[model samples]
Target: MTVLVFLDPAFADGRIVDAGKPALMATDQGATRGDGIFESMLAVDGKPRKIHRHLDRLASSAQSLELTIPEPEVWQRAIATALAAFADDGGGGAAGGGGGGAAGGAEAVVKLVVTRGVEGSSAPTAWVQVSLPPEAGRLQRENGIDVLLLDRGYDSTVAERAPWLLLGAKTLSYAVNMAALRHAHSNGADDVIFTSSDGRVLEGPTSSVLLAHAEGEGGTRVRRLITPALDSGILPGTSQSALFGAAKAAGWELGYGPLVPEDLFDADAVWLISSIRLLAPVNHIDGREIGTSDVRAALTAELNELIAAT
Candidate 1:
């Protein structure tokens, strides 16, 4: 089941629409040209996780695109309305095994979208969608995944030189991104981590690249977290950012990098993280095993605890 809520000034709490009906126009730029920005968030027990972070990123993207969007409060109200509708019996009989919006099993994927609007129209189209989180993401988080490295066809510094590329924004234009994933699937891999033309590690098609390092066996161990630099033409992951804060508080050293494939190969553990998926360990890269499974599992568990707390 799914729910849709449109942000409208006339409706103080936002307007809940029929998810089954056609809500968007065929000529809408978002539908025709993918001229929009979006953010996917996780809501558990009716509470959205890292909402501020997601909103901030969305605002940043909108600003970069010079597209006017609804205020944060409007989006918040729409999100609440959508979630409530999703929990209602009309949408689905409770989210999961747990009661509607219950803490244990009830979880939803909340998506916020803002389009450039119908061609030549003055108003932009914005809405909130709520649905169940994918079971595949949960499986990947638990059982791990296999990734293939693919070139993103641009230099790492290109975004800095050409702001028109919109590399840092999380927009609705994801054709090539989806194509990359299909390519990985055809090659018997679960996902793709893009590298720059210069061989600098970038990010996954729909996630951020994360590598961990650990030393000193059990008790006195020192663990460090590393991710590619934000300026490396990759979308800044809300989950990865939140996890870094939590990990740092728990004594994990952190580093940002202009990392390369060799760095991923040498890390203690590797993962592809995003808002919806949370965290999924990378067990193999191009058929080459990464780190030790024991170490990877241990670190994954430790970090997942941190993610849950977030």
Candidate 2:
């Protein structure tokens, strides 16, 4: 996996840099103590979809973290500049370029991460950096991904009190999140879906939940597309919103609320949605085999068409 980390001044070809760089803080540093915030967005082709929305969310998250962020326009310009430089390295120009990268046209994923700058012993520093995303390998696509239900449970009320349980914040302290993935992989699953101590579905470690139900006039016909409520404490996935709109446009009924594992087992179809992974239909959960349907394919086609049109 060839990945380039773009620093403030220019692009670099390797990992592990001199800790002397003002933007590069020490591992024992203040913000490195998991005392800050961050955000990641996909810059597909060259244009970032919902760029303003993502930036707005980032600002909200920073405010919740009691941290200040660069101005909206400034951040957007930084994102654009980093993506442009990264694409140039990929041998493509953003100009008649594909809104992003392509066959040697810079068709790569782009990510922007901003930490709480640096801190001496006393105050916040002003360092922030945006970089390109490495290509994620294709996995759990057609055949479906194996997911393990992790035993560790999160408090349902944390989102109300601390709210910054980092539930909504895309902070750098992703140790636990990454651990969940490791736990799932160790248990023979490609990912993990966190549940409450009592087994109510929360969300995938890095994706949103989508439940396919049977609808229509016919008695056992598959029906509407559903996801859990945002009030339920899941991250408000941008892709989820887009897909919901696409579903509505496709004449598919849209629903949202709580969904337990039993509900998943009972559903006609199930999928985990994300920006990069897009649609990953679940064929099996726990020990139950959920039947395959054309719903995901239809939904993906509809979404791709919607995105293309927009």
Candidate 3:
């Protein structure tokens, strides 16, 4: 059961719409030209996770596209309405207010979307969609995934040199990203890690790239988490930032990188992290295994605990 709530001025608490009916205008820019921004967040039980971060990123993306959207409070109310509707429709199983990992609770995907409204209207069409998450993401989070390194066809410094490229924004123009994923699937790979034309690691099609390093043993053990530099034309990951904070509090060292494929190959473990998928361990990259299975499992379990706490 999917729920849709439109942010309308006439309705203070947002207007719930029929998800099965045609709700959007055919001329809407989001569908016609893919001119919009969106944020996908996880909703465990009946509450959204990392909501403020998602809203902040949505605002940044709107600003980047010069698209004016509803304020955060408006979006919040609509989100509430949507979640309540989803619950009423039996989509939100039991009310477990704990973290996302809580058993016997619904784990849904909440998507916030804003599109430049009909051609010349100057108003933006916005809505909140609540639905069940894909089972494949949960499976990959547990069983891990095989990835391929694909060139993103741009240099690492492109975002800095060309601000118009909107590399940091999470816009609806995801044709290239989807195409890359399809290519990976065709090649018998489960996912993709994008590399810049200059051979620098960027990110995944829909996630962030993270690599880990561990050394020594027992009391002398040191564990470090590293991700590609934000300036390297990749979307800022809310989950990665949240996990970094939690990991740091747990004594894990953290670093940013201008990383390369060789760095990934040399790391103790690699993962693709995102809000919906959480952390998906990368078992192999370009057909080469990343670290040993035992190390990957240990690190994955450790980090999953930190995520659960969040």
Q: Quick one: best lDDT, which candidate?
A: 3
Native-referenced Cα lDDT, model 3 = 0.92
In candidate 1, where is summed lDDT lowest over 10 consecutive residues? Answer: 95-104
Cα-based RMSD of the predictions, in order? 2.1, 5.3, 2.0
Using lDDT, rank the candidates from best to worst. Answer: 3, 1, 2
lDDT of 1 by residue, 84-201 (tens): 8787744334436133221234678899999999998979999999988777887788789999999999999999999889999999999999999999999999999999999999
Clashes of each: 0, 14, 0
Tell me the lDDT of candidate 1. Answer: 0.89
What are the clashing pairs of model 3? none
lDDT of 3 by residue, 20-112 (tens): 999999999999999999999998888899999999999999999998899999999999999999888877774322223422256888999
TM-scores, all models, native as reference:
0.96, 0.78, 0.97
What does the lDDT read for residue 40 in candidate 1? Answer: 95
> What lDDT is reached at residue 32 by model 3?
98
